[model samples]
Each structure stands twice: as structure tokens, then as C-alpha cells.
Target: MSVEVTDQDAALAYYVDVLGCELRTDVEVFPGGRWVEVVPPGSTVGIALVTRESGIPVALRLGTSDADEAHARLTSAGTAPHQAVIREAYAPPMFAFDDPDGNALVYLEDAPG
Candidate 1:
């Protein structure tokens, strides 16, 4: 999947450095734009960073092995502060945070196998 970002360089740093995603591809596209792809380790699904004239609200739900640990990692990385994990009877443990371009994203604990 793709997410629109105003600055590809900043987005790349955040996703790769903060989020711990690996860089899959980084290339220049026609008409003066870049095509950058990143993915979590061992995950086939990748997120493409596309340039946009205007930013838009995007929600990306990501599954984590452990929500608490993920939240802590993000917190320690200085990428998240206000987001707190929510636990409910019917809902899985989850938390939400925004990217540099204000794109909303949710991190949820993977259901026990």
C-alpha cells in the first residue's frame, strides 16, 4: 500500500529509523518525484512513499506481536508521546499515532494463535 507524504526524505527516515522498517526500494519517478518503498522485517507487504501536493489523512492499521512493547519502542524512539494503548473486552489492545505528515496509524496486538 501507499501513503502520501509531503517530504519523502523525512518519511523515509521516520519509517526506516523510528519504525524499524527496512528500505526495499528508492528510485526516481517521472515528472520529478520519488518512489520509495519500505516494509517491516520479514513482512511481504510494503508501504510506498509517494509525494503529494497536499497532505491527506490516512489510517494504516498495523499488526504487532505485542502492543505494549511496540508502544514502548515508539515512545523511546521519541516518535510517540500522547498515544496510549487502549484495552477493551471486545477489542484487541491497540494504540494510534500520527506520522510526520499527520497520517494516522494504528498498532494492534496480533490475536493470540
Candidate 2:
């Protein structure tokens, strides 16, 4: 359950610099150049920076807890324009969160009913 940011140095810098995530490892899977995984200090797991570069970063993860509660909390907050709860029928239940740079990321909880 992680986002594949990008392999570019600048993209890596943003996550490591601004987000304060540590440089974990370099994974090479051929033809796709090099990939890196970064984790924040004191954090357990990490998200990845894949070779597929993009201006709009997106990641979707399932089987996480608290997603349904998060959706309820978000709906009550009359702040930013947000996407409604979306369930992919046969897939899991998920909702998207947009970063400051307009990158949309999805955090999922349980499978669809």
C-alpha cells in the first residue's frame, strides 16, 4: 500500500526534503531504469518512487483500516472540494486525497460489500 512517486531526483528530493522521508533503497528492475523507496524517519514502511514519471502522482492501496471512518470525517469537514466515496464494484472501497500539487492519492480500507 504505497505510492510510486517518480525516479527523478527532484521528485525524490520533494519527498525526502519536504516530507522528511529517508532514502531506503534502490531497486533496479531493468528497462524501467532505477527505482527508490523512501520512508519517513520513525516510520515503519515506505512508499516507492517508480520509473513512470508523472506530473500528477497517484497511489492506491487497499486492506487498510480507518478508511470508512476517514470518509465520514472528511464529509463533515466543509473545507476543500473533495471527491465522494467511490467503490469499484467488485473491488475494495476507497477515497481519494489530493495533495497541494494536485496529485490524487487513494487510501482504501475494506473490500466492497
Candidate 3:
């Protein structure tokens, strides 16, 4: 997955420190641009932090084994979600939150099919 962030350094810190992601790569791809990638533990997916204006808000759909546990963890880590956990019709329990850059993201209890 890819996300457009204003500052790569800050994004790296947030994803690594706050979100508990492992820094996979941090290299300069161009003169002033960088190619930073981070991946969560026990997961193969990588999130690329791109430093460019895409003019669109990022909305990442993530999954956890338990919504309540994940919510508690994130909350204790100082990430106040936009909404508390809720069960929608025909959907798994989920909650929405924003990154330091105000990029919207959701964490659902069930994994994707």
C-alpha cells in the first residue's frame, strides 16, 4: 500500500513508533524525494510513504484479530480513533482513525477474504 505524506521523517517515526511497524527501506529515489517503506510484524504487506501531493485523502483498510484489543492498544499508544468500535450491517467490527497527517484509516476485526 502507498500513502502520501508531507514529511518522510515524521511519517517514519509515526509508523514505526506509534503503529509498531518495521522500517524496511529508507532510500533517496530522486534529488529531493525518498522511497520509504514500512511493514507490520508477521505481515508481508509493505506501506510506501511517498512524498508527493496526490490531492486525495488516504484511506487504508487494515485488519486485526480482535477489534477491541486493537482499539485498546491503539488508544493506549495515544491514537484516539475518530469513532469507537462498531458493528455495521454485514460487516465486521471496525473503527476509523487518522494518522498524524490526518489520513483516514480503518481497522477491522476480521481479515479480508
lDDT of 3 by residue, 1-113 (tens): 57889888899999999999999988764456566889988898878787665322246868798999999999999999977897855457988888889878878687656
| Candidate 1 error regions (>4 Å) | 1-58
Q: Which RMSD values do the candidates have, in order?
A: 11.3, 8.0, 11.0
Residues 2-104 of candidate 1 have per-residue lDDT tens digits of 7888888999999999999999988664337566889987798878787765332235768998999989999888778345888866457888887788777
Whole-model lDDT, candidate 3?
0.79
Which regions of candidate 3 are displaced past 4 Å? 1-58, 111-113
Number of colliding residue pairs in each model: 0, 0, 0
Best by lDDT: 3
Ranked by TM-score from best down, the candidates are: 1, 3, 2
Superposition error at 12 for model 1 (Å): 34
lDDT of 2: 0.61
Worst 10 residues of 2 by lDDT: 54-63
C-alpha lDDT of residue 6 in model 2: 38
Model 1 lowest lDDT segment of ten: 50-59
